[model samples]
Target: MTSNFRSLPVIALLTILSLPLVVMYAFTLVDSITDAEPGSLIPSEFTFHHWRFLWDDTTGRGSVWIATINTFIFAGSTAAIVCATSLTSAYALSRLNFPARRFFLAGVIILHAFPTITLIIAIFLILQFLGLFDTLIGVIMVKAALELPFGIWVMKGFYDTVPWEIEMAGVQDGASRFMVWRKLVLPQVQPGLSALLIFSFLSGWSEFILPLVLAPGSDAQVLSTYLAYFLLDDSLEVDFNLFKSVGLFYALPVILIYLAFQKKLMNIYGGGSKG
Candidate 1:
């Protein structure tokens, strides 16, 4: 009786915490199917009008498809670049013997602290000089830069956590440094890679400011800009339901990626044997 009674407070606290989430989810579930009015908690008439209207591109103006593709290109490119660069750079930082290594790591730290948004104009100028402004490559470059430090830091720690003996054994077995790294180091650090990959994906997938500034052209506009268009139509504006649908579509890909990676993250972090 005493032990069970001790659990009461925990159960009570949990109920209190869950109340708000339950309410919010209940509201969201209802709103998703309804012609939900602005500033209303509950819809007066439940309907799927918003969902249908979202696909009504008979007017040839739905930016959903455009935004989706742009987001994929941006997120995919950033992930690939960040992963490739961070992997090589981190391996060096962890194992290489060189002067100014600490200084270089410090430089990476300082670079992370500097907000990319603060360098918009300077980046624009440089991009313009390099003929990259208003281009997907320009946005990709900026996003990659922003994601680099964290990726490097995370991968470096991962490499550091690995046992040196694994590499040593491989080396004694007549393996080259590159060969041992390719076979042993990479396999051990995969979870850390998963962790970094998810973070890198998130970094650029939802990025709005850099892409907005860099890709101002209609051809280059992404999901963030696409949403901004809906916001600009004040007189002919749609309701919150439409906006939510916009969010739903933009979020679907990232959600899918997260779901796919979430299990991997758990497996990695849970101390499951390395694949």
Candidate 2:
């Protein structure tokens, strides 16, 4: 009871600090569903008019559902690829003793340090040369490739936490290296893997520039790019309420993902510090 009492001040401080963000989000929600008088900040009437984009194809870039589907595919594919490649690569990096292993690890960190924007022109030219411009697969591949360094580094940290005895036991029992890794090492680092998957998915989902620059077609559009269209329209009268609704819609998945995997996400730091 005393501990709980002592924590109240910290909680109160946090709540006070968060009040503005809470109020802003509340106003955004209310504004999306309610209309204000011409000159008033207060909502005057309740309506679903701003959410009409959910049913109507008014954006002229195709249905928001198309963008949503493309986003899911792009994010899902990147997560899967990052997970698959990182698992094996990190395992090798953690357990194997090959020449220049330290140098390779250093190179991985260097690659991740470079901002994605700096390489956009080169990536754009390469995609065009490969005839993959304006395609979802092209963007997915690029996102996965870019995400690999971080994924590998994180997974390696987790793998380093695993005991060698467990692997040796499996090997002594006549299990192949693949079987040992698949059954033993993988389970121990499940938290890191889960965290990486969520991180990669969120990274891909929130990505705006790559899709905007490399895959500009309506069919390859993701939610982030779709949201930009609201302001890109040449009309002088922009519907701010509609923009808020679209922003909320775009954010809903990320919010849900965080709520669901928040615990695993915390484990990322725990695993990283182990190595």
Candidate 3:
């Protein structure tokens, strides 16, 4: 009780520190709706001109709808591929005996340790060689590949926590190895699976550098690239409200996804599977 009471000051301090970020978001939100001049505290007038761009993209480059569909494809495919491959790779590393297994486990984390920027040149060259450059499918492959190392390590951690006796019991009940894995082992790591899905999806959703460098222009643009286009196009007449509107629009999907799966995020760090 005393400790709880003593923590109030710390909490108050943290809240105070967070005020600037809250104010910034509030300002942006207000700016998106009102015809407020840049750096003004109050709006001169309110209008929906900023949001109207969603249905009617006036930039004449490409439709927001197309970019949105492309984003969903890129993010969804990246998550699915990363989760699927990571599950199998992590399971083999965690449950099976193989030479250099520990080394490989360490190696996956090591691969994640290198900064992604350093590998962009190599990735670009590889994609070019494979005839995948400047295409959405190519970007999907690159994003999935980048996400694999972390996903494998996370799933491996969860897999290591599953009891071996469960698998043996399934085997004793005339279940094949694949069946045991599918039925018993996989459910034990549902939390990890959920975490990986959200992480991989968000990673691909917000990825800027890869999409900008590899899959540029209107044809293969994702929401991130789409938002950037607003900045590039507004040189002569900068519309801060429009930029803020685009920023909010780009972030809406990720926000909704997180809200939908926030409960499962807590489960990721919680204890092992229930009976």
Candidate 4:
């Protein structure tokens, strides 16, 4: 009772501070779906014309549908590849002692330290040489590779939190090392794994530079690139409503995903194995 009373003021203050931002965002969404006048916050009339392009290729160039599909392919593939390789490599690094293990971990940090732009020229040439230039698969591979260092480090920390006793107990119970890791150890780090997966997916989903530079043109464009077209359109007047609508569309998946996994995400910072 005393603690609740003490926290009431903080909670109230936070609510007060967040209220305007929330209202503004809500109005932004409303502005997209309604026919509002220039510089007017209130809607004059409601219309679905803003969303019409989502279903039909009203824009003679093409709809964002293909780019949406390509985005899913790239983000999904990047997340899966990063998760799989990160988990195994993290487990190995956490549990096994080998030559240059520490050095390799340091190397991962060094690899991620450099801005990706620094390697753009080299990557572009390499992709061109490998016949993967301007391709979705190529982008997926690059995104996965770039995300791997972070994923590996995160998963390694989670793996460190898992008690070795758990693996030993599984081994003592006649479980193979693979089975022990699969059935026993992995479950303990569910929070970190879930966090990494979501982050990797969102990273790929929101990736702009890599896709823009490596896979430019309509054929390989993703949602991030598609959003650019709104600003780059030849129209004399920029349609803020249409741009916001598409922005909302592009953001929906990420919002839904975070909401769906919000509960699990808390476990990321929760206490790890005791021993």
- Identify the candidate with maximal TM-score: 2
Task: Please rank every candidate by TM-score, starting with the best.
Answer: 2, 3, 4, 1
lDDT of 1 by residue, 203-261 (tens): 78889999778887777778877766666656555566666666666777777878888
Clashes of 1: 0
Q: State which candidate, 2 or 3, has the greater TM-score.
A: 2
For model 3, residues 3-41, the per-residue Cα lDDT tens digits are 646787898999999999999998889989998556777
What shift in Å separates residue 82 of candidate 1 from its native position after superposition?
A: 0.5
State the TM-score for model 2: 0.94
lDDT of 1: 0.79
Off by over 4 Å in 1: 1-8, 14-22, 36-41, 52-54, 58-62, 233-235, 266-275
Model 3 — which ten-residue stretch has the worst lDDT? 266-275
lDDT of 2 by residue, 1-275 (tens): 35646787898999999999999999889999999999899999999999999999886878999899999999999999999999999999999999999998999999999999999999999999999999999999999999999999999999999989989999999999999999878888988999999999999999999999999888889999988988887763589999999999999999999999899899987883321
In candidate 1, which residue pairs get closer than 3 Å at backbone N, Cα or C atoms, i.e. clash?
Answer: none
Clash list (residue pairs), candidate 2: none
Please count the clashing residue pairs in each candidate, in the order shown. 0, 0, 0, 0
- Residue 151's lDDT within candidate 2 is 97
